[model samples]
Target chain A: MQGVNLKLDEIRKAVIEMDDVKTAQLVNTALKQGLAPQDILNNCLIPGMKEVGELFTRKEYYVPEVLLASEAFYAGFNIVSPLIKSQSTEKKTKVIIGVVKGDIHDIGKNIVKVLIEASGYDIMDLGKDVSTERFIKAVTIEKPAVLAMSSLMTTTLVHMEEVIKELIKKKMRRNIKVIVGGAPVNEEFANRIGADGYAEDAMQAVKLIKKITIG
Target chain B: MNILTIKKHGTFKVKKSTKLIDCLAKNGIPIIATCGGKGRCGSCRVRIITPQKPPAERETLFIPQSALKQGYRLACQHKITHDMTIDIPRLKKVKFTRLNANYGLALDIGTTVIKGAAVNLKTGSAEKISSVYNLQNSIGGDVLTRVGASIDGKYDILSKLLYSSLKQLKNCLGIQKPAITIIVGNPVMLSFYLHEPVNGFAQYPFTSNLNKGIFLKNPPRYVFPIIGGFVGGDTISGILQSRMHKSGKNSLYIDLGTNGEVVLIRGKNIYAASTAAGPAFEGIGVTCGSLALPGAIDRVSYAKGALRFHTIDNKTPIGLCASGLIDLLSILLERSILKDNGRLKYAVPISSRICISQNDIRKLQLAIGAIHSGIKILLHHAKTAPKNIDEVVITGEFGSRLDVNALVKIGLIPKGTKKVSFNKDLPLQGAVMAIKNNNIFHQVETIREHSIHIDLAAQPNFQEVFVASLKLAPWN
Candidate 1:
């Protein structure tokens, strides 16, 4: 048990160091040593990513470092995820997200998707430059608990409001929570656009989703 | 109560308290008011022969205290309270007869700078080259910002700013009128120049209105055709300049600027894409950043544990230009002062006023990553590896003074390319070629017809590739 704990700590350190190959190797070694995949994921990978998120928030880690750390996180997650059995039979909460129409910058959205998925949510990524009609269609079909939209440019952030107005027109506003995030988006802009919540970054986005949906 | 006299021109009666810039323009003496007489750009500066009014608060922003003390003031800020004789330094006495008959003008209207060349039509060579800051910079720093500004009903102001800058370029070149004028720029700039709506560029499925060679009758100017989306006539101009389409060797042509455009030639097929690399490469959005000008650090080298630097014109270093920034990054990486993930271990001070901060590295990383991913995606679409590329032609003002090895070391340029060369002004050269030879218009059409524009943002794997590319390390 002590040896397995040391291995899990090494796995976490490998991720923070952004060593994808070493992270994967350590995960494989721990699994071969009869460590449960669920224990490894709960004790190692998530905590590693959490530290990465904190480092990014503190500005010690930039986009490249965060991206690399995310890659390392995935390198270990991919090894242990398929082996872990689902403990809960309940249906997971669904979240639909996209970059607003006319804004193709999706890096922030991609990061949010990664963090949200790691946090155990079903994500239906609508992809970038998503139109208003498409967002409405996804909401009506996917019936997600939350609809998140992002835009990197000020010119395209208006599309977030357009999507919300269309949702209200279709009477889907009351059924789902609307969230907005991006470089140009702020609390006031989100409120002005009638979004239910605003998140400054991916970590905050995940927390916001959890608060609005589960609570 | 007041009279205004412009040296080398006739005196004009002026009303008291009227703005000197407005008064000068009213008297038919054109002053280059780049800020639209807002007293911002300082282009409308005049040297007063008589005792001038004390310098206004805004005048001190542009004019040195020594120059201000010597009776120089901003015309836009000055109100004519008394008779004044002033000299407009920018307006040159034009020799119209010498240049009117055989001279042709080529203008490359870029987002940051406007480059002009006076082509001797008979000789088919550029005689003089002049450049001016694109006055549209006052409206917005980048194309998308300007597009947003245009959407908000600042279209006329944008257009007027461009025209005023063009007039300034013409005056600088001392060309009264040319036999022919050819203009080339990115699609949005051309659209703005033609007074077309920029709505298409503001959204997905980006479309351009001007895709063919257009001739305007009033000024007898020919505007080059655009390819698609952000890949505009400037890329076509670069193609014409490089003759890449006719080359048998596989070649890549990249114009690095605020908008990085990459064109790949593989056998008979041509692929082009535009990447938004942001304004960092143009020395915007970074602390201690400036355009490639005198007093800008343009080169840096590390030897024997000492950092050596050179400024443009051998002047005191004020800030880092694109080339100097890349070189500094490479040195920092080599010395381990900067990590491959673009983390600056410490702020390295080059001068008392200039220090490279952590945020600067991040900005450059994004800019370089955008261009790197663009080149990679184009190569992948063409099914050609970087090693398969025979020649790479880099164009733009930033590329002119760039160290090719530093570019590769910093991973902005792929490492395995066979040959790399830089052309300082390909767009201007292409415009000159069009002016000298009418046959080039047919070639432009052929190139346009054969070219395929791939929207980088719409690519399915763009995010994945872009994330991988963000590393400040070399990759194949």
Candidate 2:
């Protein structure tokens, strides 16, 4: 308990208050005190993000506030992620997310990425306007457990299907679970496109990813 | 039938029945046709170098008198009757109707149109209101396209075109020199008016600098603080007029132009976001789309498999404006002629000559989807649901006469919008207010500083919420 002298409660409080400087300092201090990386993430950082997400849902925390908190969470995450490894002796559930081609809007994709990544998953963000071949390449290389895609414009929603078809054509579909969400995407479209699941918001997205990882 | 040669392009043969745009496009000639060959857009303009018959009434309505005298005609309306050589008018000409008064100008610069109202600064009463087409249309129709043109070094041309047009519009006030001028529009228009670099607007994390008290360097000119990224001075002006910031309860303000801006006021906090709602509501992209001018259809209803429409001036139906488009979609939904997925049961004719296409419905879907998502996101941010809002004040050309039921039917606005107030010229009114009382103008920064600029594009759940909005059925 003395080796865990680092007060995670203070770190959680800093994340809730959206204080990046304090969180970065606390995370660093906690690591120097020999607290396990897994405990630092699962107890201190993930809980902080989980609280931030809940505050977001309650409307107590808004986009800017959530953004600030995420900034703090990442400040800590940058330090803790490498050492954490999967606590269950299994590989970390890796996920990839991107906005579809022709639609460079990343507001939605960023939210899903932050929330899922904060919930203790390894996230590989492909960024916006990702091409089908690029997605095919990333999936083949990373072999992520889940592939999430977003499209804000109706014109670009078709790219999601294109990415999926490319995955199937490359015989990568069975290896990765595909989930789609965006302003123009729905569960019906997800079902029709043969995606594993669809989530409407960042909080819901994290929950969906957790469910998939657990399964 | 007649043969005509476009200046640079090759000669083409055409019949009187052939639309000039279609003829030119079919022959692989370059021309602007954002409105899908609709004469209302006035984009596909051509000048007949050879003498020809006078322009039709529709053509005269949009074309400047000087252009008409120069034998200018809209390609969408001008059909070939006899052999004539034509030239695409690259010149930007402006017409001014001088007013006889010493006053101030209040302006609302939309992406598609510019409206200027001269106020007797002493009494703070509007002397006259004059409007004209934005000259930037020749380069591009939407803000992004115009931004592209500006990024491509067309800033001077765009700025000069606007300056001359404003100069002409000022002539309508008939004042030799106005005491003051206040301009308001989306971020791009305000930036274009002053010839500022719009590079910030071209990418993510879009920034509009007007909020920091930086404005046009020219004297007797002022712009409202940029409220948030795409939501510009005009939106701040709307907030000023609505006085939503002073409210004890929750309220919503929407400026529903081509770029729909939404503001949620909860207690002392303000949240703003802009959605690219497309040009459908403004009558720029639809096949039979036109501005909210006389003879333009503003309302529509379906009865016994027939479409009944009401025009702006009780004249023959020219084209559908914003409100009429909303009504038409609702009627189609009610009659089951249009499915929730934006598919047409079949091609339905609105009038003897005008018909609705499946593509138009899809365009409307994308537009409505943008607005619906914006409202939801803002409300969510404010922690105030639609039902908690005290009032929804809509301010804009397209939003003024919009039917609440139609909007609800299409899931554009919340179903609980029982007391929606339409103030189409909120920016103009706010300008008048600022002129009458300098006290409110001082609070513009306080507003910009206090309110949060939410980048909805960054929201992780946006795709999920936006996808659900594609459905045309009423919101739950």
Candidate 3:
């Protein structure tokens, strides 16, 4: 408590190490000491995940490691989310992602979400096997900056375009930047299906969304 | 209406504009359609000796222009219009174990292929073996894709197709019905045989009613116990075959088939995980891959800048089979043609007819990554590393033939692998084991309760490990 700045460093270190138990314990300790939630999130959880992503890109850490670190990030995020709501409110970038209707493969999508959240994005994960109506409804309600869809089967890849057309029918296509990816999807397929961008992997998903959002 | 005729095979009458995939499936010979004949994978290709119309646009995109010119077209994409001659080229190879008693059948129902061995109960040895491409593949090459195929009410047809394929395998042994039939497969394949719902596996917390084996009337059949949704009865059989629970040394048994299943043992504790390796090892999704048949390249070697290879039966190299695919990847790695990140310096031609594409390398990477990550996770959960393991047992018809060096170079096997063993058809072997001793069936139930099943998909670090393992080099 005396060294609040140093304690924040320790929290970041725990997240990087993917010590979820330690992360939860430290978050409670920092809050009991009356540390600011926003500061903790910005200085601890976010930086911790950023380092996890960097380690991942450098080939030092793999999916299992990042997944554990993401859990650690969430452990801190769960504690700080409610507390930060009462403090200063800053606008967060909103995104919606799900495996399209009839496809439940979400391993790649989940990784993309974790990496994106680490990069400081508010992700509304619709989860896998999401219905087109649910996707349309989420777009209308969440009005996210991007709507990402994924599928592992080539048969279900058509549903991604179906959602795109449904978006156009409901006048939501222009409102959201659509991105699609999975095993069977390629840039040409993305272009053919009217997606704004296509990401090949989890790391690319984050970069693709940032390019689309910033541009 | 038109008639489709094969020069030497036979003649089949077809409806006007009906899909060639459906036409073939209806005639009891479904060709390779990994994407369920949607014309997406371009696997169900056939030679059109006579054509009435031009090829589809996607055909040009998928097939080489020369092949397209020579009348090679995706059967799924080509529709029957006029009477034409077509050729479906594939070699049929089946092993005859040895014949003794009245027929007893043991089946290993794989996602991509269904292999059955006729057992002679009197001698406790396999009599004759026959395998067929699992017709459920028209549904998909993987369980999840098959789940998607079931959405269109084709699940019943899938079951029926499987029944017919099983009969065909049985008939090859000149047996009408085995006195007893024991079927073993992963959850998805077994569930299809059991007529369980496939859609349940595609949703959250993915559940399946595939737990425990069930007996059927009339035929005296037994479906093996499924440990978990994805773990299936196949892993249970692997455990029984390897006797991992009783082994003093830490042992790892891996079945490198369509859906890669891994089992780890540390004393009395057993851990299992299934990773969707995407049929890469079975030679399903690769560019020039074929099942191990006559004329299919099964091995490759390069020394002093000389490239040489051998076929399955020492025949001419028509296509690369499973072992050849792995060896090809290994040779490319050894020669620096393939980079650690799974990119090729350029397209490498293995033959005038067979060229290794960059896409093929990526597919292998994904397959290896899936399997390698699953192994790493199961080992991690056991709180152990690869070095601590005393034995590595690879089970599968394909894995049995793999060069140990290829696995080590590709990083599929741990660098510290000390005792490596080959288990040909581990699930089938277990099924045969259970058939010989019905008491072992009870042991499977015990095996299920004692082991821990890890859903690699749900594992937190699966993605990280998978991505890291995507490197085409050995793990340091």
Candidate 4:
């Protein structure tokens, strides 16, 4: 048990250090030592990512560092995720995400997508510059529990409201919790656009989605 | 009844509750409101010479308390409640007589700065060279930001700002509406100047409305033709100045500024790509970054385990400009104070107010990554290696001030290139050349006909290449 605890600590440290190769090697070693994949994931990888999120919020880590840490987290995650017994897919809540039309800045959206996936949620990424019709089509088809919209430019911020209006017009607003984010987005603007939630960063985004979905 | 009087300019009859900015514009006063009179940019600041109105909530955010105390207020935030007199600072008129009838004005509208040259059409020699900050910068510091602003229905405001800047440049050069004017800039800037919608640049399959040379009747101005996507008239101007299109040797031309446009010439093929390097190279987004002006640190050296630096005019160090940022990064990497992954070990203070932070290094890394990856991808598309390139031409605002060794040390330019040269204001030079010889337009059209634009974002391996290039190390 003590040896298992030490191995989990090493995996967490490797993630913080953004050492993808060391992380994959350590995860493989733990798996060969007869450790449960779920236990390794719950105890080591998620917690490592949680710390990374905290560091990002504190400004100690930036986009490049966060991206690298996410890479390291996935390096271990890919080796362990398939080995875990499949959960009931029906119980999982799906989130549809996209950058609004006229805005191609997706680095923030990509980060949020990774963090939310790491937290074990279903994500439907609609890439960038997605039109309003496409968002309505996805919401109508996917019937997602949450719709996440991002725009890095002030000009494109109006598209988020347009999506919300279209959702209301299609009578899909109540079925999905709409959340908006990006550099130009604020809680006031989100409220004005009738979005259910707003997140300042990726960590807040994941947490906001979790809270809105579970409630 | 209310009367609004400008100190030097004429007074105007105004109604109560009219926005000061709108009143000024209606009265033919050229005031810069980069945020379109939204009380955001503070560019339209005026000094109240009459009864001082308390600063508005937005004014407090942008104006310093001392300035406010001295009767300065944002024009957008002020309304004509009563009779008022104010002073506008930037409307000072310069006194200069027209020198000659055969003079031509050449203008390069950059995202950050607008440069102009007064040329003797007969001799093709520049009579005067001057530059001013692009007033649209107060809307946003980058091309995309301004494009977004234009998309948000601020096109008229942006166009007005461009004209005001041009008017200022004309005044500085002492040329009052030369017989013929030549304009060269990026696609977005040219579009803004023509009041054309920039919605095409807001998304993919980036189409430009100004792909051919246009002549305006009222102003007698000739706007240069753009290539494609973000590779606008400036790159065409650069090619014209370098004559790389006609050369047999493989040559790379890079215009490094807010937008890093790379053009590779091999045989008859001309390939170009525009990388959105942001304003990091211009020192807009960094913590202690500034434009290359007096008091701006433009060079740095590490010797005897200490860092030494020099400003543009041997003045107090205000902040790091592009060249200084590159030199400082090279010195930091040499001392291992900054990691290859762009993490700074600690903040290195150049002065009491200015320091190189970890965030600054990351900004530089992103910028360098964009340019380096752009060059690599262009080379990959051309089926040529960096070593095979015969000449590399670097041009932009930094020009001769940039240290070639430091740029190479920081891995911005490819390692072991055959020859490297720096040309100052190639776009301006090309515009002047066009004015001197009207037949150059035919050559420009030929070059445009042979050019191909590659969308860097659309490339499959762009993310991987960009990430790999982010390391502050020499090319392999």
Best by TM-score: 4
* Residue-by-residue lDDT tens digits, candidate 3, B1-476: 78889655579888999987778877767567776665667777788888547788978766778888889898878888789888876525443333445868888887767777788877768867777877666555556666766776778888888888776677667666678889888787887788888777664455788677788877888888887757888888877888776677899888887668888888777888877787666666676776666788888888778768788777777778778888989999888888776767887888777888777777778888888888888888999988898888888756227888788889887887888888777788888887778788788877887778887766665556777777667763
| Every candidate's CA RMSD | 7.7, 15.9, 8.5, 4.3
Ranking by DockQ: 1, 4, 3, 2
| Tens digits of per-residue lDDT for model 4, B1-476 | 69998888878899899888778765556665544465545557789989877898888866657778998998878989999999987554644545655789998998767898899887888888887767675565566667777777777877887888788788888888687888899999999888788888776778888878898987688998888988999899989999898888999999888679999999888999998886677665576776676888888887887789888878898778888898899888888887777777899998777888776787788889889999999999999998999999998756126777777878898888888888878888999888888898898888888888998877877766877777778883
For model 4, the local distance difference test gives 0.82
Score candidate 3 by TM-score against the native: 0.77
Cα RMSD (Å) between model 2 and the true structure? Answer: 15.9
- C-alpha RMSD over true interface residues, each candidate: 1.6, 12.9, 6.5, 2.9
What would the per-residue lDDT of candidate 2 be over residues B1-476, giving only the tens digit for each residue? 67878886668778766677667645534455444343545668788888788789978866668778988888878777778798875422344566555677788887666788878877888878777666565555566656656666777776876776576566655665777777777788888876677767765567766666453444677777687778887888888888877766688888777778888888888899888776777676666676676778888877876788898879898678888888999998988888775667776787875677765676678788888889899988887677887788887665227788888899888888657878878877777677556676678777877778888767888866776677787774
lDDT score, candidate 2, position B67: 70
DockQ of 2: 0.03
Candidate 2 error regions (>4 Å): A1-103, A106-215, B1-97, B214-218
Instruction: Estimate TM-scores for all models.
Output: 0.79, 0.62, 0.77, 0.86
Residues A126-157, model 1: lDDT tens digits: 98889999999999889999999999876787
lDDT of 2 at A40: 81
TM-scores, chain A, per candidate: 0.91, 0.91, 0.88, 0.94
Error of 4 at B220 (Å): 3.7
Per-residue lDDT, model 4, residue B329, is 91
Instruction: For candidate 1, write residues B76-177 as lDDT tens digits.
Output: 788999998998775545432235547889999987678888889899899988887676765544677667777878888778888887887888776868
